[model samples]
Target chain A: MQADYVNPIFKAANDVFNSMLQLEVSRGDLETNDNLVSTKEANISIGVTGDLNGSILFSFPEDMVLDIVEGMSGMEMKEIDTFVTSAMGELANIICGNALTTLNENNYNCDIVPPQVLIGKGQTVAMSTEQVLTINLETDIGEFDLNISIS
Target chain B: MIWKERYKIGVEEVDRQHKELFNRLNDFLQVVRSEEDMEKKAAEIEKTLNFMGEYVVVHFDSEEEIQREYNYPDYEEHRQTHERFKQEIMEFKQEFEADKCNEELVMEFSGKLLTWLIHHVAGADQKIGEYVDNN
Candidate 1:
């Protein structure tokens, strides 16, 4: 993620969580996530369009995904499955949509494709094994990571 | 969720339709998410989707008339959003009618409907209020 992408996406997360979920979240410094794999992470990838054509990957730990689903839906997301994955993907989509709106006002006309849940622990994003940008978003129950690459 | 007074723009006709829209969508969501029998749920779910298809066009037409009355600066983009969503919902309902047993698509449509309503109200429609205030 570039600084622009990182900051705006983080700002979007903050605004959305605060307004929609009424949850205050904090983020740590941007770190590298070269070894991150979706097979091990409960993440959703949403594609972007217009000025930005890429995929924003939100990598969450299984426990954190459950925590988020529980927090958002007021129900128990006992395990990571289609229901849980779809819910989380919708969250990511909301965040991305909010971010796109902000970016649009900043002269970045962007839209997003629907969100897709990457299941299992073997599929990879096939990015260069470099120090990709990531932020550890700490919430009350758990934390999540936001990873992005513009293709 | 029901449309609140704060959601109104002081426009009689448009505001009334928006309220009806929120009520219909909220009712649809309630029934769709009900913890009820799957066999018995199909009728009500199908009904809501069919209603949404019609209500959206009527609601958008009424709101757009108000938008034109006020010369809404963002009318084009706003109408575009409505158009795209209407098309998507139509597609979703068409798919549901084709395969009534596809639980996955129904759930996906439900989730999208929930999120879309909240954002459209809290974010997009809120701007109409801003326009109303300024003009």
Candidate 2:
């Protein structure tokens, strides 16, 4: 059940990144690093719940975040403020939304929350981690850490 | 995941290939994004890069061939899109070798490709699917 739920989401994320961003990405191991920390300029997170629940967080250094947003919107995203964060959040949302559809096909009825953009230092969200799986993605643009845990 | 019934765009051969293309992309991405060693992941990335460059071109060509067969109204527009992709792929190949640190370019490219394919299939190419359905 966990395999079915997470694999598709990971695949869809790769596909979206491949097609939408044109950067080839590979998954990282399900590392158990709860105290995971990043000094990257921006991190956008979205929540998943019911039957399967956790969070997908996309982290990027300042320039990388702007580059991603600029490409998606076809406009220059100069700063790591509200508008840029919202745009980045939407990309995460789209990936999760597609992943949910993939999950539904495999018999897991799950839904997702609106994506949230976290700003500044000390923005930490905890997960059950007891049975969590992290779909870490290493890409040319940056890295996306997808942590999935069943509640 | 094999191409299910839902993604069909009506044209027989092209539809078959489209499903195959999606499956290949999925497989390629899975390998690329695998939580393995960096060397292993980079190996897969290099391998899949070839597939995307060569295979995607072939796929796009075949798709265009089908469009031509049916006299697709947006043929010129579609062709231009393909041309742009081809050019960008070449540029990426060069940049990839020259600049290892510039992964941002790669990420941006992937995002654009993902969004473009969905809209192209669901919006532009779907017209052909509609035509085949109607005819």
Tens digits of lDDT, candidate 2, B1-135: 423455567788777777666666555545533446644465566677777678778888998887787787878988997898789778877876675444444444454454445545544566778865665
- Where is model 2 chain A poorest over a 10-residue stretch in terms of lDDT? A32-41
Question: Interface RMSD of every candidate?
Answer: 3.4, 9.8
TM-score of 1: 0.78
Score candidate 1 by lDDT.
0.73
Candidate 2 residues lying further than 4 Å off, grouped into runs, are A35-39, B1-135
lDDT of each: 0.73, 0.66
Clashes of each: 2, 27
The sequence of per-residue lDDT tens digits that candidate 2 reaches over residues A30-71 is 665554343355776778787777766656667777787565
Question: For model 1, how does the per-residue alpha-carbon lDDT over B1-135 read when each residue is reduced to its tens digit?
Answer: 345565566667767877788777767766666777756787888998778668889988888887888899999999999999998898887898888776667777776665566567666777787787789
lDDT of 1 by residue, A1-151 (tens): 2666667889998877765555788986666666445634687887787876766778778987777555544455567865567767777898998888788887888889888788666556645335456677877766777776663
Best by TM-score: 1
